[model samples]
Target: MAFKIFHPISFIFLIFILLAPLGHAKRSTPSDKTSSAFDFIKKLKGCHKGNHTKEIHELKAYLEKFGYLKYENKSQATDDDFDDILESAVKTYQENYHIKPSGIVDDATISQMTTSRCGNPDIANGTNFMQPHGNKHESGSSNIHTVSHYTFLPGNPKWPPTKTHLTFRFSPNYPVSSVAPVARAFHKWDLATHFTFAQVGANQNSDMIIEFHRRDHGDGSPFDGPGAVIAHAFPPTDGRFHYDGDERWSIGSVAGAYDLETVAIHEIGHLLGLGHSSVGEAIMFPSISSGQVKNLHPDDIQGIRALYGR
Candidate 1:
């Protein structure tokens, strides 16, 4: 009886050993594969060497997918290991979203990563719609504004030259004090192109409508509040510009403030039918550094010119 029991027990132990590898394989799959980016980010906070590597890899892929990082060779597999490339990409992403460029995964960076954003991509190199040009830096401004790479919206759409004067109105919710900055934003674009903006009181019969909205303010493209997206504008004839009211907005150099003019210039570029550009200095770039004032880049000027001749 003892010998028979030992044989059965040994057989069960052998089966367990054979299945253990399969179980380990399942468990060894990176947590990033099974969790949301946010969950992965939560793990990255203050993570050390030999830790959170899976999350780092996931973030590198995210930035690369969104045009923040460029891979030299398409055939090369993305390294699962966290390296300098991944760290730099994280820093660049942080700056774009106005988070301090700590070069480490931080809460602010993670939050921006998880926030819902404009469907538009920050870069469009592969699309035929983009009119690629070598970057040119203009002379004599504190910051050069050149049209580096000009890309267009679907169909390369632009407002008809005949419709040179565009009318606009502030959503009742827009602070009256903010009108000056909005007008300034419009002026910056107007100087670059043939179009002009007129701010009217009525929302109807306006070429563009500007408003400050908080979560789900209708129009299907809802604001995600303060950090992720400061504002978004409709392309071409749509003429809807919305700002995330939850942002800590300021006109000038205020610590931890989102520069209103800089954001407006970007959104207005969208309203004028410009898509995001890969050029870091271009106002049309999808993200902004906090409190950093931007001037138009040649890429921006060239874009508008390509659409509507200067």
Candidate 2:
């Protein structure tokens, strides 16, 4: 056998090359990557139609990811130019979020865009589910009326009549501490809706699967780590609920941590066929603040009732 000898300097250089990737891996965490992913939107706050900046491409991608922007062809969706389609998408997004439909990216728009929200699209399959449907009478009040902001996934998918009782199971990799909070969330929905939910062992078959995932975890929808997209779920019959493992999650209100039960309630709504609600206080609202604990608002109850009957 022949052995190749390296000079001292060459050997040191080779060792550095081997260890360089390890050092980089240590520094580049999910939070850092997520921050860089969405930080560019802050720079495009004032951009409008006809303004072409490289950052506009990022804006287009953000809009596209949440179902605000669509394209007739591949070329139309790829460019950075702010065209009529882009303006229309922006206006529609503003309208859905209750922001002024100025067709320009304003401070409020940027604020809403950067807030941590669910991974599901505000508008799915050309349907703007976040828009208020109309005014509705309060459940008990004779004279008071409120706007109904609850919505459903496109085509209004729901569990069949035969499947009134559903089973849920956590992934084998799920945190053991998360079970109680998540179970409480399911109980909240159980009380509000007609459906009954039960927790099954991980090895047993289940109607729904809940798991914590980071970045791309095989599902078509990937999480953006801590700040941007916290969690997401699929509609009924598809039953995949995912939380971003990168987030600082707690059982209840913690100064800087997300409330696991609150997020669980919102995602569970999706698994039951509800969509994003325009009402900010509703459990089905797209975004949530850190350390906040939200319960099922009247609007949330109404939404579920509307989908599956009271």
Tell me, by lDDT, which candidate is best.
2
- How many steric overlaps are in each model, in order? 9, 0
- What overall lDDT, based on C-alpha atoms, would model 1 receive against the true structure? 0.64
TM-score of each: 0.61, 0.84
- Give the Cα-based TM-score of candidate 2 against the true structure: 0.84
| Model 2: CA > 4 A from native | 1-36, 135-146
lDDT of each: 0.64, 0.82
Tens-digit lDDT track of model 1 for 11-120: 55546534641221111111212222235556677643344355566556566656666678643225555556666666766665567887777777766676533435
Instruction: Identify the leading candidate in terms of TM-score.
Output: 2
